[model samples]
Target: MTIEQRYQLAKAQYESWGIDVDAALAKLKQVPISIHCWQGDDVGGFEVNKQALSGGIDVTGNYPGKATTPEELRQDIEQALKLIPGQHRINLHAIYAETNGEIVERDQLKPHHFQNWIDWAKKHQLGIDFNPTLFSHPKADDGLTLSHPDQSIRDFWIRHCQASRRIAEHIGKELGSPVLTNIWIPDGYKDTPSDRLGPRKRLKESLDTIFSEEIDSTYNLDAVESKLFGIGSEAYVVGSHEFYLGYAVQNNKLCLLDTGHYHPTEMVSNKISALLLFSDKVALHVSRPVRWDSDHVVSFDDELKEIGLEIVRNDALNNVLIGLDFFDASINRVAAWTIGTRNMIKALLYALLMPNDQLKVYQEQGDYTKRLAVLEEFKSYPFGAVWDYYCERMDVPAGLDWLDHVNKYEDDVLVKRANKS
Candidate 1:
C-alpha cells in the first residue's frame, strides 16, 4: 500500500479498537528503529546455555583472545549474523575484552583485512554497530579509570575506536550507510572508591576529544552515547552515568540505556521520560528483569512487563535500537534469536496499541472522573487482542518458548516473591 493509504488504514484500525486513531497514527509516524546485539555472547566471552536455546549456536567466546586469527573473528561474525537476521545492520561488541589481556596487532590481520571486513559487511547488507567498550576481561585494567592512571595500559581501546571510525567513515561515505559508534565502560569502584576518578574522567574526556577531533561527519548521524551504572553493589565514580550522557548530548549523541544498570529503585519508564525530555536522544538495551540480574532477553509476563511495554508504546520510540540484552551463562543461541525477534514484533504491536491518550487529558484537566473513564478504557482492551492482531498480520512461529523458559524458573521464584504476605 502507499504511505498515505497505510496511514489511513492504521487510523481506521486504531479507531475500531476504541482508541484515538488520529493520535495513535500521528505517534506512529514519528518513530524510527534499529536493533543491536545484546542477545549473543560478548564475541567469545561466555556461552549462555538454557533449555529454551536447545539447538542453537553456543553464545560463547573470548574476544581478542579467540579472535587471535582474523579468519576466526570473521567466522564468528558470520555465525552471529545468521542467528540475528536484522542484527547484521547493527553490531554490538559482544566481547570487548574477548581476547582477555592479549592484544591483536594490526599486522595480525592482512594489510587490507579491515577493508575486507567492511566489504564483507556490505556484501551481507549490514551496517556496523561499533560498541567499542572496556569490560570483557576479568583482568581488563581500567581503560576508563585507575588501570590507566599513568598510560600504564596501552592505548588499545583508543586505537580501536580510531580505526573503527575510519572504517565506518569510509563505508558510510562509499556505501551510504552510517556506522554507529558507542562507548560503555564497566570499570567502577574496585576497592573503597579510590581518589582516582581522574582516570575515568580523563578516559571519557579523551573519548569525547577523539570523537570531536577524529570522527568523520559521515559517522555523526549514527553516534551513540552509552553509560554503565553501579559497580558491585555500592561503588560508583564521580561522573559516570549522567556525566557521559551529558557530554554526548552536548555533542549531539543518542543515549544508550542498559537494562541491568539501575539502583533497584529507579524506574525505567521515568528514566526514559527524563532522557526524552532532555534530548531527542535514546537507544534501548532491551532485556528482561530477573530480580536484580539483567537477563538479556525479551521479557516474559512479569509484573513490570506491561508497564514497560506501555512506556515504549506511549512514547512511540520505534526508530531506536533494540538490543536483546540476553547475557545468561547458558542460553540456547537459536532460542535466544527466535524469542528476541518474536518478542520485538510483539512489543512493537503493544506499543502501537497502548497509548494513554486520554490519560494526558485527564491529568491536564485534573478531572478525577475523566481519569477514571480513561482507566476503564484501558482495562477494556481485548484480552490478548494485541497478540492476536499481531499473529494475524505477521507469520508467527509456534510454541510460547519464552513462557516455557520463564515458567521453569520465573514461576517458583517470581511468584513466591510476589506472594510474600
Candidate 2:
C-alpha cells in the first residue's frame, strides 16, 4: 500500500485506542532537537591551538573526510539536515569560533567571532545553542578548570564561561530565540583527591562569578552538566551529579543530563521525573556509550526509547531541551549525524505514539497486568510505517532512501576533501 494509505490505516487503528496519530505527528514536528556541531569534526574545533583533546574527552578513529574548517562543517551539517526530518537547532562550542586568522583568547571572545555562524543559522532559519569549551587549553592541562586551586586559572575559566553566556545572549537576541548556554567542565583527579570539598567550593565560587551578570531569560538560559568520570578522572570528579543537581536547584538554573555521563546500569530516564519537580527546565546531551563514557553515535535502542517515554509521559517536552552529543569518526561524519539524529526523532515519535494516558490510567487503577500487556503489545506496532510517513511529510527521504543522499554527498563532497589532503 502507499504511504498515505498505510498512515490512514494506522490512524484508524490508533483512534480505536483513543490515541490521536495526527496529534502525535504534529507534536513531534514541533519538537526541535539540537544537533551538536562537533560530530562533523570528531570534536576537533577551529581553535588556533591544535592541542590534543584533553580533560577526559577523546574521539577515537582516524576517519577520513572530517570537516576541518568552519565552512566545511557547516556544509556537512547542511547535508545531514536534508535527510533528517523536523525543524532542529545547531549546538556550538566556543572552540568553533571563526577568528579569521586572529588569536582570540577564550575569555576575550565576543559575538563577532560567531557572526558568520549567526548569519549562517539565520539563512537556514535555525536557532543556535552555545557551550563553553573548558578543555584542551593550557590552563586546563592539569585536568582542572573552574575548580582549580590557583586563583588566576580559576578566574580565567570563569571569565571564559561568562563570555560564553554573553555570546549566547547575542545569538539569541539576533535570532529571536533563547540560546541554551551549557557549561560542562572536565575537572577531576586521576587518583582520589585529598580534599573533594575544596574543589567543589572553588567551583561554586567560580560559577557564582560567571553567573553574576544576569541576562534576560528570553535571550539566554544556563545549564550545568556533570560526568561520572573521565580518562584521567577515574577516581574522583568534582562536578559530580549530586553537586550540579544541588547547584541547579539552589540557583534555579537548568541541569543538563548527558546520557553517557553516568554508570552503565544507571539510566537517565529514571532521573527525569525527579529533576522536573524542582528545576523549571532541564537540558540533555543525548549520546550512546558502549561500556564507559565513550561518545558513540546514538541508536534507536531501549534506553533511548525510555528517555523519550519519560519526557512524553511526564508532559515535559516544553521543559526539556533535547540535544545530540556524540562523535564517531569511523564512518562518514554526515551519515553519522543523519543516523543519530533520525534515531532520536524515531525514539520521540514512538513515545508520542504510545498510549501514555491509558497506561497511566491502568497503573492508577492498580491493573499491573493490563499495563504490562499494553506496553508489550505496543512493541509490535507498525512504528516503522508511521516513521516513514513522518519523513515523507517532513520532505525528507524515507527509510533506506536517505542513505543514497548521504552516499552521493560522500562521493561529491567528502571524497574531494580526502583527495586534496
Candidate 3:
C-alpha cells in the first residue's frame, strides 16, 4: 500500500482514541536530537596530541571507515542526518578543536579553533552543543580531573572547563541559540577509597571556580553528569548521582543523566517527573549499556519507549534536553547513528500516539485493570504506519529503504577512505 494510505488508516485509529497523530508528528519534528560527533570517529577527536580513550569510558570496534578529520566527521553527520526525520543539533567535545596542527592546550582552546565548525554549522543550519573533554589527557591520566588531590591539576582542569564554557558561549552566539555545555569527568578510584570526601570537596570547589566566570544563559547552558562507576572508577565515583543532583540543585545547573550510568533496575524515566518539580530543565545522555556502562547502540527497547512516554506524558517536552551519547563502531558507523537516532524518535512517536490523557485519567480514577489492558493492546497498534509516513514526509527513506543509501555511501565514500588509511 502507499505510505499515505497506510498513514491515513493509522491516523484514524489514533484519532479514535482522541490522540492527534498529526499534532504528534508535528511536535516530534520540532524536537531536535543532539547527535554526538564522536560516534563518527570512535571518539578519536582531531587533536594533535591525542591520547588513548580513558575516563572510565571506552569505545570498542575497529570500523574501517571512521572519519579521521573534522571535515569527514561533519560530512558523516550530514549523511546520518539525511536519513533521520528531524532538525537536529551537533554535540562536540573540546578535543574535536582544530588547531591547524599547532599544540593548543585544553585550557587555552579558543573559539577560533572551532571557526570552521561554526561556519559549517551555519551552512547546515544546525545548532551546536559543547562538552569539555575531561578524560584521556595527561592531567586526567590518573583518572582524576576536577577532583584531583593536587592543587595544580585541579586548577588546570578548572581553567579548561572555564575555557570550554566560554567557547560554547561563542558558538551559541554565532548559531543564535543557547548551547548546552555539559561537563562529565571520570574522577574516581579503581578500588575503595578512604578519603572520598576530599575528592568531592575539591570537585565542588573546582566547579565553583569554573562557573565563576558567568556568561549569559541566553548563549550557553551548563550541566553536570553523574556515573555509577567506570573502568577506573569501579569502587567509587566522586560525582555520584547524589553529588551532582545536590550540586545542580543548589548551583542551579542542569543535572545531566546518562541512561547507562545508573544501576540496571533504576529508570531515568522515573527521575524525570521528580526533577521537573524542582528544576526548570533536565539534560539526558541516551545510551544503551550491556552489563556495565558499555555504551552500546540504542535499541527501541521497552525502557526507551518508557523514557519517551515520561517526557511526553509529563508535558516536559521543552524542559527535557535530549541528546544521543552511544558510540558503537562495530557496525557501519553511519548506520549505527541512523539506527540509534531513528529508534529514539520512534519511541517518542510511539508515546505521542498513545492516549496519554485517558491513561492518566484511568490511573487517577484507580482503573488499573483497564489501564494495563489498554496499554498492552495499544502496543500492537499501527505505530509503524505513522512512523513510515513520518520518514516519507520528511523526504528520508521509510522502513528499510534507508539501508540502501547507507550501503551505497559506505561503498562510495567510506571504502575509499579505508583504502587510503
Say which prediction, candidate 1 or candidate 3, comes out ahead on lDDT: 3
For candidate 3, what is the lDDT?
Answer: 0.94
Candidate 1: stretches off by over 4 Å = 1-14, 17-38, 45-88, 94-103, 106-127, 137-139, 142-147, 152-154, 171-175, 220-234, 291-293, 300-319, 368-380, 383-392, 396-421
Candidate 3 regions off by >4 Å? none
Worst lDDT window (10 residues) for model 2? 47-56
Instruction: Put down candidate 3 lDDT per residue, 31-81, tens digits, no spaces.
Output: 989999999999889999999988877888888889999989998999999
User: What is the per-residue lDDT of model 1 for residues 1-421, given as tens digits with 9 covering 90 to 100?
Assistant: 4434554565565576567644533453333223444443333432221112211112443221122233444543454444332223545442322232345532121213245546766786666555543454322433243124545342555555555555556656655766555655555554566465565566665566457555566654434433343434134543456765776677777777656555456555556666666665566666655555355556544323543454564563643554445544345443455565555555454555654555666678889797777556654454244453333333332235334543443344323433552
> Once model 3 is optimally superposed onto the true structure by TM-score, how far is the C-alpha of residue 234 displaced, in angstroms?
0.5
Error of 1 at 73 (Å): 10
| Model 2, residue 288: C-alpha shift (Å) | 0.7
Task: Kindly report which residue stretches of model 2 are placed more than 4 angstroms away from their true locations once superposed.
Answer: none
Question: Local distance difference test, per candidate?
Answer: 0.48, 0.93, 0.94
**Best-fitting candidate, measured by lDDT?**
3
Task: List, residue by residue over 125-149, the lDDT tens digit for candidate 2.
Answer: 8999999999988999999999999
Task: List the RMSD of every prediction in angstroms.
Answer: 9.7, 0.8, 0.7
Better of 1 and 2 by lDDT: 2
